[model samples]
Target: MSTSPRLKTQDTKARDAEYQALWQACDRASRKQEYLCSHHEAKRIILESACHGILDKRRGQGKIMCGTSIVSMVHLHLQRDVNSRLLAEARMSRFPSPPPNDMPCLANPVANAGNPVGYNDIPQQQQQPQRVSPMISAAEMALRNEVTSLRQDVSLLRQEHELVVSSLQILTERVAKLEGRQAVLEAYPNQGIEGRNAWMLVKPMSPRSQTQGRDEDMVNKAADF
Candidate 1:
């Protein structure tokens, strides 16, 4: 359940490494490009590499990758690489430079006006930009996606549980109604002596008593008429 997405089958791992190398090359080649240009080039490189494996200039042609699975894996890796790069660049841009060392109290003010302090003249140390690794970025993305999937599963389970509980409640109420009806039927004979007699008549009779009862009822009816 906790397997890393990076640790795939042996062949898959090999292909993934190859793809990473290709993307890294692309990253280096496009470093001087503008944001949108770099992004588009990265995408193009990824698609080309995924479709037609890594190219070997010495060999003069691209080796074809075997399946869509490998291509898709490379696509994800490329996206992570791009994201990590963008994040690193953003971090680098966000940090403000330390203030220039208070211009050495020059005894002579005439020296400052000749060359308005160029950035190169600043002796202050520049903060080094923190780098975010692609692997770390990939792991973070994987964890986020996993969490989202789990939340969806939990929501579905809750809905199913509620449905089951409602069904059970309906069955329980139906059973209670049936039991009440049965109790009413059971109490029918307690109404009066006439009810008791009616219940006795309603009860099942043996074959001989059935014939005798039918004959007695007909005789009584004929006499009354």
Candidate 2:
């Protein structure tokens, strides 16, 4: 069941080659002035494709990659020449901002007995408030609202579809029942008006006709059979 190191190395090289191809594709897409997607979008597509390939390969090999490992792989492959520190900072920003300065850090009471903490002893770094574009915020809000509306619309449409299907099913059952009655009536031609009425209910269009001649002929044939 053990895999050879040579085979492992070959697999690793093949994976790296695939990622390189994805990077090349992103670069080519960026160079195309007429490309419909933006540079970031192209990069996103390449990353997604590469991730999907990795996932499929992992499944085939019966191996599972940890979430952090997968994320690290994606970051490494996509931003090969980018600063690792910058990427770390970007990821940190995605999490909840650090607790306010007033919040106390957890420490052993016994260890801090002789050394009382003070604001003067604390380190202070100049912090700048990050500015967000109003247009981008507005667009994001609009998109969220649009997504909510679409979800509601989809639910309503699905309910309507179910209702239509149920109604058709009921109609089908009724038609089958009417057909069974018609068959019985045909076997006994002298069954009377009730049988004829059942047939009329099943085929309602017979009563509302542009041609009386055709309708009469149909009724006569039914009565004869």
Candidate 3:
């Protein structure tokens, strides 16, 4: 059956949309990860700068206690910022929202807690036997029997073919021997010449004359020749 072109186009479009959405989500996640890394780096640099500034101030004041306290506070703040950004990133990575409670799980048809559409309530469809005419059934059985007979006939034919091939091989050998004998006879110059002369001498005679002449004289002439 032919499919509707429009429907096929729509289906393709839907699949493309789904793929595009997935790709976009992946791109966004990647960018977010990059941004988080950059932010973390920048925060570290800022914390380092704060510590260095505090140390320089302590050197001018000749008091290390205040510098240490300020630096520790700055480090604590940087740690808090890093943790918060990590938490935000984790939350953002939770993508393509989970399936709805009403949706069924295609993978596991036998419903569990994950699938709300329970298999228990679904009615089982009983398959009915297809009706067949008695004549048709008889015809089918006859055809099957005929096919079986044909198979046997084919096997017999194969055996016959093998026998025929063997016979041909024997015949070929016999023909080869006969041809060799004929060649040897032809190769005998005297015999070939005498045979040709006899044929030439009798070939011109009429059928009746040839028969009539086949007596003592003809025999004596043949012996002489």
RMSD, one per candidate, in order: 18.7, 23.5, 35.3
Report the candidate with higher TM-score, 1 versus 2.
1
Candidate 2, residues 15-127, lDDT tens digits: the string is 77655544544433323332223354465565556566655666688653433234454455446524643664565556444544754565555665666652133445645
- Least accurate stretch of 10 residues (summed lDDT) in model 2? 29-38
TM-score of candidate 2 versus the correct structure, residues matched by position: 0.27
* Residue-level error in angstroms, candidate 1, position 85: 8.0
For model 1, where is the 10-residue window of minimal lDDT? 27-36
* Candidate ordering by TM-score (highest first): 1, 2, 3
lDDT of 2 at 192: 20
The RMSD (Cα, Å) of candidate 1 is 18.7
lDDT by candidate, in order shown:
0.57, 0.56, 0.54
For model 1 the local lDDT of residue 139 reads 51
User: How well does model 3 score by local distance difference test?
Assistant: 0.54
lDDT tens digits by residue: candidate 1, 2-111: 66666556558656656665664444333322222446556556455533433453135453442434455545656776797798778755755565565654344555
Question: What's the distance in Å from true for residue 204, model 2?
Answer: 30
Please list the residue runs of candidate 3 whose C-alpha ends up more than 4 Å from where it truly belongs after superposition: 1-136, 191-225
TM-score of each: 0.32, 0.27, 0.24
Kindly report which residue stretches of model 2 are placed more than 4 angstroms away from their true locations once superposed: 1-136, 189-225
